[model samples]
Target: MFDTEREIIESKIRLCLDCGKCTVVCPVAQHDPEFNPRLIAQRRLSQNSHSPQDETIWQCISCYMCVERCNYYVKFPEFIHGLRAEALAEGAQLQCTHGGALQALQHMMAREDLLQDRLSWLPQDIELSEQSDTIFFVGCAPYFDIVFSDLEVNTLKGVEGALRLLNRAQIPFNILANERCCGRDLLLQGDREGFLALAKANMQEFARYGVKKIITNCPECHYTLKVDYPNVLGDTGIQVMHLTEVIAPLVQSGELSLGELEKRATYHDPCTLGRCSRIFDEPRQILRAVTGLDVVEMEQSREKALCCGASPWVYCGAVNRQIQDQRLTQATATGADILVTTCPKCQIHLRCAQKSRDGKIPQVEIQDLAFLAARSLDIGGESVG
Candidate 1:
């Protein structure tokens, strides 16, 4: 629907100083030495066979580490995104994880005629208001419940965790029974058409429900809805907020009281939430609100945080596991018994790596930030992080 990625990349390419800073900071390059960002730029601009379809393009996790570290402001991840769209037009495809089941799930939600049974995970007691103009968007966790069953992760639990907090804080919001996937993965994989289709459909849903604002627990959904939707679909009057952004103030004001949790925890900043969206503090603030929970930091935190290595959900290989192991090891080094994250995908990827390693890495429990916060809340019942 737009011009080719070359023009944008070319403008930035000219500014590139052939600096190896991108390569030095790249998590993928750290694990796999051959996949260099500086080299990737040279090869991509050259006439040699290292084309967009080459592994060089797909190898990027799009963590934006290079762009974060680059003095020249070269958006290598955005370059890959554009090149992927171009490559995909020429029959190139990424080796998607889960046998492309996750991608297939996204495509199914793009259908205008389809009605998704998406609200089965909603808790019985959480209050919902039919007249409320706000929506607590539950993105892809219900389907992930079935698809990522092997990991034994209940992503819906994370959603429930967020919902319960909203209820406790007396924030009235409705859940979209037919909410579609955010189509972030589709856009990343170069299926721009699919991404656009879903974005339009989701906007239509927002209009139909009179949605004035959206709050979500998933960082990917938050980033896509808060940033991507408006950029692609124009300003649709709907504003988006991550659950942490909405709840952190309540915790700080003493409106929402959380019980104590005696555990040592280290936070993993999801790339989309921390670096991409600059929501580094809210999650940490919420974690700190839990009384007696010792929050430790990894060596790489905030702008320099290591990626979850599962962005866009493509090319899950040894390199991804290596990065996951590195992250898990970092948590271990911090002497934290639990590794907390706000992103469900990060939890899944790290948990999968832990599963694969079979006690090779340190055995730190992976927990969701909102869930951990929710666990601390007990107006009547009990919970855990």
Candidate 2:
């Protein structure tokens, strides 16, 4: 499902005409000159038959803005994912601090105890359904790792929220504790072997559950499951959904009440969430429902929103710091006191960017829509943001 290397991808590049329309609309380009999708596509075509270019290719956040803006309809994430795979084949991997994150991901996957312990945030007695039509898969992130302590709680809340919505709507879902990491990090880092392993594990677990649909809050997980899984796992009869997509209907029907929120805020579209999956409205609709909250739109909004600069991995020192400053400045310029997003990765990176700003510029509060929605609903919850 992730493969994009074919005559068609090359054909799209040839037709690109170097229009630069994609660059003008790229979210990453707003904050990062190093991450121009158009330039990357041009470079891929000029390469000596798949020779790896600079590490910047790996820096793409899998946001689909480039595709949306490009007249060629080039598949940005598939191309980048393929490029990273080829780079590793050429003996180049993640550059800078991103390499450290790669190591951490590998370590967590290798240690089952760590994986099990990662979900310590839930109660031991909390009931988890073993048989239902749908299952909620929560992707691993720093916030879920740090705050939940027990991975079960953070994962459970997602399931709980889904279950609550489902219960009210009479929709039921099963919980799969055996689901492993979606291997998106490895895929982004070009660890094809690791990605395949995790994919196989997740596929086997999904098979055991015998479900036809899967829902997850994490865009990374949603992307991996919906796009990549089918390539390796065949037709598992599963439809992957973001929690926002699943909950939107419930919210629309008044199953999930939108409570009072009195603040000015803007939304950051997660590359994996909005760009990769074309999910731009569900989160926005939720935000809109909040009473008295002003939802400010950034100059680069929706399909053209800027990247948070923390995915494929973080750059170190001045490079990453500078990118963060640029994003914060844009967010603050919206005249919003808070910035909301759906992806945990976006939340973490933006918050880090916020902290790095440290009052030098007008600082805006960073938060995930889940936490914000939870706040709106008076549902007790915590966020890494």
Total colliding residue pairs, candidate 2: 8
Provide backbone clash counts, one per model: 0, 8
Top-scoring candidate (TM-score): 1
lDDT of 2 by residue, 1-385 (tens): 4453662364366677788887777655665677677788777778465544566775565656678877768766667777777777778745646347555665456443433544455434334566776876756752344543432223334434444444444556666655677887777666777787788777777776787888777788888899777765676678988878877877788776767788999998877787677888988888887888899988677777767766555334454556567677888888997888766666656666655566675567766676666666555243323
Best by lDDT: 1
Name the runs in model 1 displaced over 4 angstroms: 6-11, 47-52, 379-385
Candidate 1 C-alpha lDDT tens digits along 229-308: 87777787888899999998888898887778899999999998988899988888898989999999999999999987
RMSD value for candidate 2: 4.2
TM-score of 1: 0.95
Instruction: Report the error of model 1 at residue 382, Å.
Output: 6.2
